[model samples]
Target: MKKVLMAIVVISILITAPLIYNRAKIEWNNDTYEMIVPYEEIRELAIRGLDTDTIVKTLYDNGVRGISFEPTGIQDLVKQGLVMTLTKSDLFSMLQKEDENTRESILYSRENGLYVLLRNDLDDRWENAIVKSFGDRIDKVTDLPIFKGESIYFIKGISKEELTRGMGAVANPILTRPIGFDENLMTEFASYGFEPVFRIGNNINENNEYVLDQMKQLQDKLGGHKIIFTGNTMLGVAPHKDLKTEDAEQYALRLVNEGFVLMPIEFTKQDGLNIYAKQFNNKIVRLHSLDFFDGRGGYTDRATRAVKERNIRGLYVHVADIKKLEEETITAEQSFEVATQELEAITSQMADKHQPGIAQSYDLLQASKWMTIAGLVGVAAFIGLAALMVSEKIALLTFAGMLLVAAGYIVTGATMFLQAASLVVSIVAATWAAISGEYINSKKDMVFKFLKGAFLALIGVWFVMSLLYGNQFLVKIEEFRGVKLLFILPIVLTFLHVIRDHVKDLAMTVVRNYYLVIVAVIAAGLMILVVRSGNDAGEMVSGTELVLRQKLEDFLFVRPRTKEFLIGYPLLVLGMYIIYQGKGWEQRIGKYLLAGGAIGFLSTVNTFTHLHIPIYLSLLRTVYGFVFGALLGLVLIFLYRLAKKYWPMIQERL
Candidate 1:
């Protein structure tokens, strides 16, 4: 009775301590930095070969957060000094109203000190039209295409197709506004050697289905470098009360699922923008426009305010009228200072907002095919070792083996890759140490007993570290409350074996009465309810990410991490008969596996209690593990009885 009580007390401590330690050790992180600036601003600074800090500081100071003007032939114009004229539609309208020809328009632009950049959706006959109307030479924009002639210089971003063949293009891909054909036109353009830097999908329709479909198709074809934007997606009025954040979040998740990797700024006043910033900070580049040389300085202040308020990661600036911007007294130096100061402020705030939450642990098994196999094999070896009685010397060797393997994994930098293997090692060592410590206690050898208990305690520490932080020594806070039956089952079973002699009669009486089977089944049902309650809950391997684990269960007719249900519980029942029914290896092995049912019961219910896993799914998984495992256990028990009866005939034949 004393031994049984001691075993229970020690097991109780062993099970809860690691979980508490792991929970206490978790760390959570929520810090991100993102922004944009103009192409010319980034280029001019880079070309000047300024110090990197100076460049970053200058860009940030100037409010250059997100879209840096992509370096291309535009720098050549920047060298001649940039002056903006009317937009394409406005320019064409003015030409029609004034009856001015292309040459006269170019000449008028030059007189205003503007560099005329032609926006050509202009038909292929533009050269002939210009020649007929203005009697001027029209140049073909080719690879190595240069225009020194004071006429209208065409300024579309040169594609990679042009650059690879000794031609110069803008560093960015051109914006392709597909006509009525939509993304199909984009496909047509890509096939014909047009590479868009980013795609803009017009999503202002009654339902955004067409826009969403086009974006998905474009992302699939265009690849990673090209980002697709949902231009005015849900373009209704903002202050955000009208715009649902949930709707925007769904749209964002859908875009990511479909592989659109970046986002541009839309309506900023909406809290939905913050949702986007939180959800897609790394995946999407959300921009706040500073509008550096625009006529209104009012836009600049609002842009800064939005950056601070919404945690918007990047800033963009597009200046059309340099002359109009001068009236606001916004100098290049002043803008640079403002951007740098704002960026510095954002950085400072990011540092403060950081809290020591749960440390993150990545799944080591999910990374590679080879590592996956290694983990599964490790589990097999661990179960094999844990199923038998071994000497104290063998237990010490097991302890040393875990240390050696962990050391090897660390040196090879494969700790994360061998996470499951490391976990098995730690568990086996801890289990053996615990059982050995109890043996020493029975002998009343105080000094040796203390030493064994100390070793067990040390192994317990290693178990927590290996299971919680993993190989990378990082703890993801979400793991704090997660249950790991991997450690709990084996070690608890080991201690149960140490108490078997003391609890034998009581165990056999229950088994002989046929009550153990009933208890195991009832326990399975009750555990399902405990799984619904947070504090008392166990665990199950739930969630969609456990892809391979689920696959193995489907293929093998046994669930992964469910050995306790199928193997452990049935062995417990079988062992009860074997202990008194037979002698030799069968009896001894039965003694070793007698705790399987108890361990199995734990395996079923706890598998569902994984912190983030849904309760309904967890219940279904637990029930399946229990029923299947119980059925298999019955088969093994029947087989063992048959083998025992046939042993005399088999011996005579041999």
Candidate 2:
């Protein structure tokens, strides 16, 4: 019975597990609504360069049919007549001319069964108190309303066709107006069959006015319509009163189910623009305004000359329009297009300023591939030859072989591409050293002990460098030269001392000082020269007017220095350490000399530039190297003792 119950429980969990695991299933609106509204015409109203996808998405989210289009190329479309203009009859003029109770009218006109949108605002009393401020351009004055008494005047003329054309315009200036207003005005607009699209408060502090106004009016409109409310800034006058924090979703939900066409506008932001079209189950149509300059100069030239090209549908002014713009007060439409072109030019320039880091890395990899291949072949040949020599000398030679393998790692900057080769070299070298050291002891065969020592040394190199440079050295070749190579040198030197068995021999004294001085001088000189040259080359190549030489210098010498120090320092330390610890007491003679060389190299880096890393990482690298070196020493001693113990078994295997 218990078994049966357990099986049942398991089956139940299996059946429900997927449902619980896959939470938050995306809800989609499969209802396909025919886009009956002429969105292309509406898109032509805004600036041409506006992304049509943006506008279309915005409209569709608000349950606005085909009337939604990005304002990208609407301005240019207006000039081109691809988007229709509003006739006087096309005006949906809402006029409230009464004194106490307002009078209102919404004059809806259509051209061949197509809707046009044009909206104009007039106060209850036309304020001529001061000259109207319409920047710069002014021509003819046809109808001017004369203010009378204390009563407010009201006339909103909307050209449906012109608005549709404006919507389709490629580029245009932003159109802004006040938000939710008093109930009386709302009623007036509603009475005329015109939905209160947007309203403004009497003052900035009118909280919940937008929501309040909608709630009051929504009684008359719901169940099958859409309403869009757009907030321009953090300070909005609507349901924002209820929502203490800024969230677009809360505001959207307030109006989506209501039977009003929703449309909102907002500025570009980093998180990304809020698009509402998908909520209403509609796909957005992006429209872009093609600039005449960009179209004629950029696209045309690239298309003709380049191996790869793309077609563009953008806003471009005609040569005739360009001439017309200079002499006369061009149409507001024309002004909108000029503004769009300037914006596009600025956007394109900003985008071109940055190149991705991934691309730069790929370029470096392309250069490193051949270098890695050569290193692998060289290391492999050396290892195969050393293994075949099999004798007492071969065991001793293992220490020297390991050092050579470690040296290669330093030279190559410990690159990811070279890692495979480096690993193979390290393993082979370590094995030889372990087996050889054991044979030399002849009494205690401690091969395992020596193998541990070798392994530790290899690990020490990697850990020490990581502490010094972090993972940056792995990815950034510059860090390898600047920081890693410094560590690699010491490892190489220690290895050399170990192979020669200098502790019991007199030959060590002479060999020690000579190699130390040479290494120190080379390291110091390389560091100083490379840094100084790097600075000079950077200045000469980067800031110069001469392009060809500058480009050549950058590709050849300048860029490589970026990686040199990062790769170099670690290799130097590894090389020096391997040499120092490998031969025991006799190798101590060279320690001071190697130290001086490291100091010299460090001095060069310090004097030239403030490129030294943080103090903490440097200290960490130092501690790691010292600890690792000590561990390796202990292991090497153990292996020597162990090999002597197991001499007979080791000799038979050898």
Candidate 3:
């Protein structure tokens, strides 16, 4: 019983192995910094093609995650969910509430999964009042210190776009906030998994004994919490020269060495070595594009060359930018909502456009490589197996067909037509030889076998005709080079089986008259080529961008109909039809003929992109092809009926 149970468990493990193997997960390592980029915000930047590096910095400063927003409250009248907004009335009410309820509100705010911002610069006496609102539940704020404001002054009467423009301004209210370090906030932050951030003036001495004293005290209490240095370092200058800069870097380096993270909050682009990389040599990881958050275009500083060369992490945007959007007299919640929606739309669009196609292209290339190797092995095995299973004549033919297919594939990078033609030829030959060998031994049902052969012969003749004509047309088109061996050849063999049968039985009367047919087609093709050449006499010119001139140059000198098309046409049509067509395959056969004729006509018509064709001439060319195809179809029908009428009498003598 124990053995049985162990066996079942092993079987289950085997079944589930593939699912585990293929699961997608985020890859992280010490060498490769894994910054969790908020994808949605990044896309807005991409659409505008703005600076990417600044976008990343803004996101990190704001503590923004790529998560969707949850509704904050229900609208009273409309009964719809509303996002949290900043308003004087709400701030006043929340502040006026007892400390218990205020704390309760803050905890509840987080409980509902929405970010809670403590209204700012209210007096310390009011802090007790705010604390009374929550009672003992102050510890319930999970995942961070309560974001506080030193001075809670609202910008008066400004359009949201104008405020967005002011995000980079020195006069921005966000810049003037007083610095305060709270030990209580730090304790509470550790309990709730939030790192306490202190805002200090950019000019604060890095080596200041007071700041070091405060950091050591906090480190001792919290066991190691990051101190966020918030200030703008002057652009295009050495941060080391500034006393405050040296202190900030020293503090960050010491903390980082001692298992603490130092995050500097800078409003502008300046060198601070928060994140260092070989690609971005000597530059600090800080927000850039301090110009403005126009909402239309985001600020990004990612290198374009970098994007092309390496995998990108993601993008970020400032939460203040989202909030500033609401200062347009609209609620802050509504502003965040709009920004969130915009972010989602942009990210979705970018992912849809780029990911799917790139993935498919990659997968196809991989499959092609594996499939080619597997096919070669399969061919070799089949040849060996056939030599043992069949007569030398049939096995040799099969082997020859396989070799041709392999050669074609090697030369052209594809063997679809060659492989298909080989298969058809092998099957038809094997069947014919087996039946003929049986009849010669037994002398039974020879007439029936002969009839089948005659049918096959007819099929082969049709296949040959189509292959030749199609190749003639295909070779004329510049794009049809490698396509012939892989596609056109096999297609011809598919239809040639009927002719093969006729040849096997010696019932083909068409071969006796094949010379006459070939001569007639050659004559017609020559006349058409001459007429096409004559039409281009004056239109063709050297150094011209005209389509006719370019085509004439090609047709006259390089890859002319006489050399390539004439030889390729017969093989192409015959091979293509034999492979692609089925019994009662008139429609399939017709399509092949039509495609060839269409190419022939289209080749002569000028298709220069820069050179515009006159509307009248274009219309004339369209009508000319239509009339030509119709006439040609009619003439072929007449020839087929003529052949059918005399085929029986001529076959009797043969």
Best by TM-score: 1
Per-residue lDDT of model 2, residues 363-407, tens digit only: 011223333333343343444434454553563464345445546
Backbone collision count in every prediction?
52, 153, 64
- Order of models, best TM-score first: 1, 3, 2
Q: Tens digits of per-residue lDDT for model 1 on 1-654?
A: 224423532453444444334433331121233344444454444444435456654544433333321211223332444322233444445445444556354434332111234344433332233223222222332211133332453333333344444655433222221212233334543453333334344322332244345445555675323342433433222334654445556766666566444545534333344454334433343445655445455453344334322333344444322332345455544545554665554444333333111111222211233332333333333333443355545544654455465456556754343454434544454454434423221223523532443344333333333243321222111232423544354536664664567576455653444666766874674465335434223455466635665465445433434455555445554554455455665565545554443454344333432322222334455556545655676688689878868989999999
Worst 10 residues of 1 by lDDT: 357-366
Residue 428 accuracy (lDDT) in model 3: 36
Model 2, 521: alpha-carbon shift in Å?
13
Backbone clashes (count) for model 3: 64
My TM-score estimates for the predictions, one after another, are 0.29, 0.22, 0.25
Q: Which has the higher TM-score value, candidate number 1 or candidate number 2?
A: 1
Candidate 1 Cα errors over 4 Å, as ranges: 1-565, 579-588, 595-602, 609-613
In terms of lDDT, model 1 sits at 0.41
Better of 2 and 3 by TM-score: 3
Model 3 residue runs over 4 Å out of place are 1-179, 183-201, 206-255, 260-268, 271-293, 298-316, 322-327, 342-654
